[model samples]
Target: MGANIGDNLFSIFNSMTEYMIDAGQRSVLYWDIMRRRGNQYLEHMAKNIPDVLKFDYELLINGRSLPEPVNYGLLKILPPKGVAIDNRKRPFVVIDPRAGHGPGIAGFKADSEIGVALSEGYPCYFIGFTPMPEPNQTIEAVIRGEAHFLAHVNELHPKADGKPVVIGNCQAGWAVMLLAATRPELCGPIIVAGAPLSYWEGVHGQNPMRYTGGMMGGSWMAALLSDLGHGNFDGAWLVQNFEGLNPANTLWKKQYNLYSRIDTEAKRYLEFECWWGDHVFLSAAEIQYIVDNLFLGNKLSGSEIVTSDNISVDLRKISSPIVCFCSKGDDITPPQQALGWILDLYQSVDDIYASNQTIVYCVHEHTGHLGIFVSSNVARKEYFEFASNIDLIDCLPPGLYEAVIEKINYDTVNPDLVTGNYISRFEKRTLDDIHSLGCNTLEDNRCFATVKRLSDVNYGLYRIMVQPMVRAMTTEENAKLMRRLHPLRLGYELLSDHNPMMKPLEWAAKWVSEHRQPVKPDNHFLQWQTLYSDLLATSLNIFRDWRDMMTEQMFFGIYSQDWLQALMGLRASDAPPRKHPGHDPVHLAFIEQRKKEILAGMDKGGPREALIRGFIYVRIPEGACDERGFEMIRRIRAEHHDNHLSEFKKTCREQFFMILLDARRAVEAIPQLLVGREEAGQKFFEIIRKVATAPGPLGKEADMRLAEIKALFIPVRPEQDEK
Candidate 1:
């Protein structure tokens, strides 16, 4: 018994000693990681918050020098070694979100949106902003500046196949739509990755972030923050809000991941932190407009936001094909918010058709908001497939569709026709499809409506009661001090060399690294540490869920009261909590005029028209289209015609509408289209046949359509013509 007790004591002592050594080693490595992070932050700041784009770029147009004098600038990304840019191909203009952090999240790495465009031989450009805004610059000015940048890109690549493909990340996504709506001619195909146009949209139980405005009493806090900052809203506040959405990730998992994998995780952690830490500023006017119109009023999708010059912003004005890439895992911009604009703008899928708009949306099941733009996996697959098939999307018939990308399997038909590792196809969708994802009910909308009304009241009260004193007390020096001491920046400041306490840490960390002795994987203490960290994270997650539940309950309870709704000028039967700006008369006239033109040209044109018409007719019955089929058509067009992509798109749209208007007349008129070009008709039918078979055997309906088209293309011999 004595010997056993002695052995137990020795074992306990040995375990304690090993734990201390391991703890000491981990502390040294963790602080070293923090020190490196601080140094990176300092370096990134010293460079004036330059973009994190991995590729080299040359400045093209500086928005500060434009007539609008905004802080945005356009950069032309240079092709890397062994990459050749084809000016004839469409250009890609990637706009990073300037919500809080500095730009370049869109192209933060080599395998990113910009990289995919460059790999596909498209000229790439970036629109990034500086850390500081131009004095008195407004959001409208920013939109105009972006428009000018796009026009310049268009001029630079006059020989390109189509207008520049504008890609917007997060905040930039809505900005892209705004630009496209106002200046429709400048945008080609638009891709909005993790962008939220409908701010109030979310699932009922999840996406607690949407309720934050109500919980905080609305835009008044934002106004107060801007006033306290001396007319500049600190972007760190926005970053903090994002972090607050996931307490487990923000409070424990992130740091613990680094602490546990100190040997291998520092570089990536520092790289991402460099972007996250270097916050930017928004002018007071800008934030006010964003919160008032977008966040509170939920106006952009409804066409309710008008410009200072009295021009209303209408999303229906945009003619480009819009591809929204959102993720189910994104708590920031849920798929509902990313796609809710469709339901807002159109009452039905037919309205989309009437507007002659092509909207394609893709929802990723697992990618987070940042991953939508940053993950190398997403870049290699989604971005690559998107870049390769943009032309296909652009040429699709004007309507709603879901872009479904699936892995190639053994059952895949003609797999060689599909490019890369995945095959991309667009399946028809409707507003019902968006509704199925999840949306706010009438009661939820009424609650938000009340919040908006109360927000305006509170904002006015703050402006009258608090703004003057706050402005009087705030100064540039105080603002700078406040920004420095922000919780987000405090960590970097405290861990940096500037802190005398941390000064000794540099050398000590180096010494410990050289003499490092890592604990074995089977170490009992190490396992216990991991368990403790996980439990902490789990606890935080539970707290977050409970907090979110309380917030939601509070928001709904306060805003959903009948008295509050009545006070806010909203009733059960009055106007909807929000009303969509009905169709513009001029837009209606334009659509009518387009219909007249389509009717006039239904039976016009010769081989080109017949070829495109036949392709549409063959695929229309299937109710789905794939990039493989579109690519085959593009190759056929390239070999047979020299028409520009814009012209081809125009003809395709006209033919599609013609067929939709009168399928029997459209098919019967095909013989007239092939009156003299019978040989070309045969070739076109052959092209359509190849495309139809490339994916697999067509459905019965599609096969019948193809037979009808083939019969139309058959020439009558002189001897048999008498019969």
Candidate 2:
């Protein structure tokens, strides 16, 4: 017993020794990472906040040089070694969200939107802004600057296949859509990832960020912050808000994760911090407009925003295809907020068609808000597939659809026809499908409506009574001082080499790296340390949930009060706060007129039109079309030098809507379209057959439809002589 006790004590001594050494090494490494992060932030700022995109770029059009000058600029990406760019293909323009962080999250790494586009041989452009905004720049000036950039890109790629494909990340998504809506002809296709279009739409228990404005009593606080800044709003305030959404991450897990895996995690942590820590600034007018028109008023989708020129902004006027990529795990921009615009803009699915717009959305199961645009897996699969099949999306019929990307496997049908490891399908959907995702109850909408009303009242009172005094007290020098003193910035400034207190850490970390002795994974103390970290994170998460619950309850309780709702001009009803005005007479009449025109031209074209019409008719029952079928069609079109993609797209749109108007009549008229072109009809029929079978066997409904089309293409037998 005495010997055993001595051995146990010895073991404990060795364990303690190992843990102390390991902890010392990890501490050195972790602080070194933080030190590097701080240095990178300082360097980034010194460099005027250069984009963190992995690729090289050259400035093409600087928005500051435009007639309506803004700080934004358009840069053309220079492809890396071994990558080829085909100017003849559609150019891709990526606009990163400038909400708080500096630009390049959209192209921060090799496996990103820009990388995927370049790999596919398309020229890519990035629209980024500098750290400082031009004096008195407004959102309208920014939009005008973007319009000029697109026009310049158009001129640069005059020989390209079509207009530039615009990709908007987060906040930029709404801005891009607004640009496309106002200048419909300038955009080819618009892709918005992790963007919130309907701010009030969210699940009750899960989404807590939407309650922030209400809790703060609205944009008045934002106004106060801007005033405190002497005009420019520091982006760190926005970054701080994002951090507040995940207390576990903000308070402990993020730093603990690095400390636990200090050796391997430093690189990635530093890279991300390079972007996250580099905060930018927005003009008071820009942030105010966003808070008012988008967050509080929720006016973008409602088409209630009128420009200084008296032109109303309407999303339905966008001639380009709109693709929305969102995630269920994204608390910042939940799927409901990302896709609820369809519900807000149109009363039904047919309204989408009548408006002649194509909207496709994809909801990822578990990616966070940043992962939607930053994760390599998503960049490889979703962004790659989107770039690969952009033309297909551009040509899809005017309506709502869900983008479904599936990995190819042994069970995948006709895998040979798929371009990549995944096959993309656009499944026809309805407003009901959008509703299926989730939405707030009418009471919830009314609560938010009250929040908006109260916000206006509060902001009005603050501006009237307190603004002059605050403005009188603040100056540009004070604003700059306050911005530098922000906690987010102060941390970096203190940890950087400029601080004498941290001067020893540089050498300490180097010495630790030289003599690093990592503890074994199964070490008892190390195991306990990990367990402690987990407990800390879990506790923080619990606190977060509790805080969110309280916040939500307080917001609803205050906003849903009868007197408050009455004061806000709201009542408890089945109707939502924001109601879609049913189709106007002018739009209804236009739909009828367009239908008559389509019916008149049912038999207008020859073999190309016949093939497209027949294909649409046969595939209509399936309710989805995959990349495999579209690839076959593209191959066939390639063989015919006379067929331009633009013409092919027009034929597709016309035939698709015609069939939507009257399927039987459109199918019957296929023979009429192929009349006097028997040989061509036969060839086109064979092409369609190959495409239809490329995705393996069709269903019974599709098979029957194909058979009907085959019969239409068959040559009529001459009457038997004197039978």
Q: Give the top-scoring candidate (TM-score).
A: 2
Candidate 1 pairs with clashing backbones: none
Q: For candidate 2, lDDT tens digit of each residue in 1-723?
A: 999999999998898899899999999888877888888888888895577989899998878788888999999999999998888899999999989999988888999999899999999999999988988889989998999999989999888888999999999999998899899989999999999989989988888999999999999999999999999999999999999999899989889989988889888999999998989999999999999989988888778889888888889889899999999999999999999888888888878888999999998999999899889999999999999999999989888889999888989877877888999999999888888888988788888888888889999999999998999999999999999999999999889888887778999999999999998888899999989999988998999999999999999989889988988787775467787745568878988998899999987988888888888888888888888998888877778764467878888899999898888888888778877887676778898898887777889999999999998997555664435
RMSD of 2: 1.7
Deviation from native of the Cα of residue 650 in model 1, angstroms: 1.2
Candidate 1 lDDT over 1-723, as tens digits, reads 999999988987887788788789879889877888887788888895466878899999988899779999999999999999998899999999999999988877889999999999999999999998987778999999999999999999888899999999999999999899899999999999998899998887799989988888889999999888888999999989999999899988999898888778888998899898889999998899899999888999889989988888899989899999999999999999999998888999889999899999999999888899889999999999999999889989999999999999999987877778899999998789999999998889899988888999999999999999999999989999999889999988788887788778888888888877777787787889989998999999899999988888888889989998898788888867766668778878988898888888877898778878887888887788897787676677678676488888888898999998887888888888878677676676787799876778899999988888888886567889787
Model 1 TM-score relative to the real fold: 0.96
As for candidate 2, its clashing pairs are none
